[model samples]
Target: MSARPEQREDRRKDPVDAIVDQWAAVRPDLDTRAMEVFGRIFRLSRSMGDRMEKAYAPFGISRGEFDVLATLRRSGEPYTLSPRQLSATLMLTTGGMTGRLDKLERAGLLRRSPDPHDRRGLQVTLTEKGLDLIDRAVGAGLAVQSAGLSALDDEQVGRLADLLRELLAGTPGADH
Candidate 1:
């Protein structure tokens, strides 16, 4: 019912190969070489994100929620931050963060309090339950990501990371 290693490898035709072939046949003058890279990268990004979300499902959190908790957890002592700070750090809009915060607060995973520094502003902090859950979520997330990238050897992965960093460095809003 399952494929052996060779059978699996044989069936995997580097999906982009087919895409390139298809484009080449229809548009003889067009150069689709970049398709080989971006196509796979797009698919890989989506699939990896899906797998990571699955990993969070058992912990009863979406990737967004996990990110919020994890960010708060690592934000040093008091584990607190203003809504604006959180939205900025996560690249989310304050409006979007409000929905997430409301959900987390209802779950008792985080709490909001009056910001001492700014009257009429609120700060968010993780509850004890949130801290514990995020600790486990982070551990599980790392494991899921690690397993997903296991096809690459250490040197290959390191090189890939460096290459990705370079690519990210040039992209707008990618945090230079």
Candidate 2:
């Protein structure tokens, strides 16, 4: 039989391909397209997450901490938000947010102050140090990601991004 389109295009036998082949051998009746796609996505996420963790490590932050700092940095001037806002944006629980805030505050990377408009609420603001660290960390993280994507050309990357966006939009409970 002639090689499949994917096989003809690239003869690589990735882990996901190996898995699909095993399943096919055992149960040829099963359809594994979704498994193949999601399996590759899952593996990519894991591997990239590790690379990102390492990328942020030199700045003395984990991926989660980087998320917190990045969120604030992207918020623009004054770089302040309510604790509740931060929790919501990060999709983290209030307790979890508190732990991160405590650590960042202790490290002098951020500050917590009583909200002037709301006596009962508190505001979180990024310190100069936090902003500087996040700026550098973001660049490093992007470098690592760019290197990983170097295998694909610009058009291929764009197409992949569009496809992933479509998949994410259709996914249940995913943010629009």
Candidate 3:
């Protein structure tokens, strides 16, 4: 399903409309057909993120915050990791991870301390409060994600995941 025509009509008149129009004119000979599927995926990703954010609202945490806490929770016993470890594991830069840690700390969900093994490093640990919050938030997030995927049966979802994985693996920088 898509947004109503009333919503789409407004976008069609927007500035970026010219890009698609030009593409259609210049590439009439080539297939250029994959654009339809990939373009919708890009657009739907944005809309789906908005929906997921709204679903996280009741927990009073942004999705990014939840991601950090969840990562720490899943790291096994002691439920702690160094800032460097978290940043690398989450594919975030050091500065970006620091900002996330600051917000979570202010929310009383996590705490930071000097790493015992490395003077230059810091360990980020989920506070008891942070652990509880993530536990609940994760449950809610799963429900929302499951509902979103309900349009496809379990078997279909499995096949789709496999195909996507194969495609991703064949792409350059996938291993990087």
Candidate 4:
């Protein structure tokens, strides 16, 4: 059953505030209030990630694979990226990127070819089969993300997005 507005607000407050209360109880001088926001953000991230993983499951790819495919698909026509470019964009180790590329190539979703710009390096591109799979996977992934934030009204969601964008932009290690 759906909660009444007051009840829903109370439910949200109780658990999260209880955490801060516990910290204040044991260590009164310490300020742990930021935990409320950071904790919620962490929970939201995990929940959305879990949902998106389920969304990608039918396409037979993990979240990391989906990330690579989506990055290539978004890179515009030719849908190609060098292994270095992909690894940098994804912040993956060379071995990690190589592993994902190997799995996708084996799955017949993508292929690696000699980089035209740098003959010594290889580039990755989505096959026609990869294109179709990623198109569907992206659509499904968006649906999952949309549903995850459906609790918020449009204005709240927009405001939250803006706030998050600002925070992410200022944070260390976020894409500059």
**What are the lDDT scores of the predictions, listed in order?**
0.86, 0.90, 0.79, 0.87
The TM-scores of all predictions, comma-separated, are 0.88, 0.94, 0.80, 0.90
Clashes of each: 0, 0, 0, 0
Ten contiguous residues with the weakest lDDT in model 1: 1-10
Candidate 2 wrong stretches, greater than 4 Å:
1-6
Residue range 76-160, candidate 3, lDDT tens digits? 7698999888888778899998899998899999999999988998889999998888899888888888887888899999998
The better candidate by lDDT, 1 or 2, is 2
By lDDT, who's the top model here? 2
Q: What TM-score does candidate 4 get on C-alpha atoms?
A: 0.90
Kindly list the per-residue Cα lDDT of model 1 for residues 1-176, writing each as its tens digit.
Answer: 11111225455687777777677678766666567668988999999899989999998999999989988999976899999989988999888999999999999999999999889999999999999999999999999889988998999999999998888887897772
lDDT of 2 by residue, 80-105 (tens): 99989989999999999999999888
The sequence of per-residue lDDT tens digits that candidate 4 reaches over residues 1-176 is 21111234445565666777677678777656467678888887888889889999999999999999999999988999999989988889999999999999999999999988787989899999999999999999999888888889999999999999998888898754
**Backbone collision tally, model 2:** 0
Better of 3 and 4 by lDDT: 4
What C-alpha lDDT does candidate 2 achieve relative to the native structure?
0.90
Which residue pairs in candidate 2 have backbone atoms (N, alpha carbon, C) closer than 3 angstroms, thus clashing? none
Give the higher-lDDT candidate: 2 or 3: 2
Q: List the residue pairs that clash in candidate 1.
A: none
Least accurate 10 contiguous residues by lDDT in model 4: 1-10
What TM-score does prediction 3 earn?
Answer: 0.80
> Which whole-number lDDT from 0 to 100 does residue 101 have in model 3?
91
